[model samples]
Target: MGRLYQVTVVGFKGERVTVDLCNTEEQMSSMTVEQLKTKVVAKLKINTELSRISLIFADERLDDDSKLLKDYGVQHMSVVQLVLQVDGGRQL
Candidate 1:
């Protein structure tokens, strides 16, 4: 894990999912928000086709699957809030 960084993904229940994102001294190599979501799902053993995963950073929802994480101001060592809506879009 050389030249990597940590982005702490904290769930609604205060659960944490650690993801070691690959990076360089400059910017990230086109890491998309969807990829991060995938890692979160795998780490937490959540759904494969997650229709309920949400990544919130700086009080803003990173809803675009095609967008990069850095485009949403998600820098290294950032704390992203993960909200998994259970029971059909309800936070349960």
Candidate 2:
């Protein structure tokens, strides 16, 4: 069977956007959050440190080791938000 997941993309410098991805059961069950993070980074061309970013899988904080559709609690066709923390470009 195929699974549909809503992937939300957000960054400190850009507006939030959501994308949908379809994956097979095998693919969905085997992909880790870190792997998904890499995909997001690649698709978005994020050059900054990924450690500074927060990925909310289905509105919950995603564990780096958690799998996209297996370990993470995301509903079918649900939205997953990726947020990056920024300090408004000001130095303290």
Q: Top TM-score: which candidate number?
A: 1
The lDDT values for all models are 0.80, 0.62
Which candidate wins on lDDT?
Answer: 1
Q: Which stretches of candidate 2 lie over 4 Å from their true place?
A: 1-6, 10-23, 66-68, 86-92
In the range 1-92, model 2's lDDT, one tens digit per residue, is 55665566664456565554446756656767776667677777778676656677546788564555567765445456667666784311
The clash numbers for all candidates, in the given order, read: 0, 0
Model 1 local distance difference test score: 0.80
Model 1 error, position 77 (Å)? 0.4
In candidate 1, the residue pairs with backbone N, CA or C atoms under 3 Å apart (3 or more residues apart, or in different chains) clash, namely none
On the 0 to 100 scale, the lDDT of residue 41 in model 2 is 76
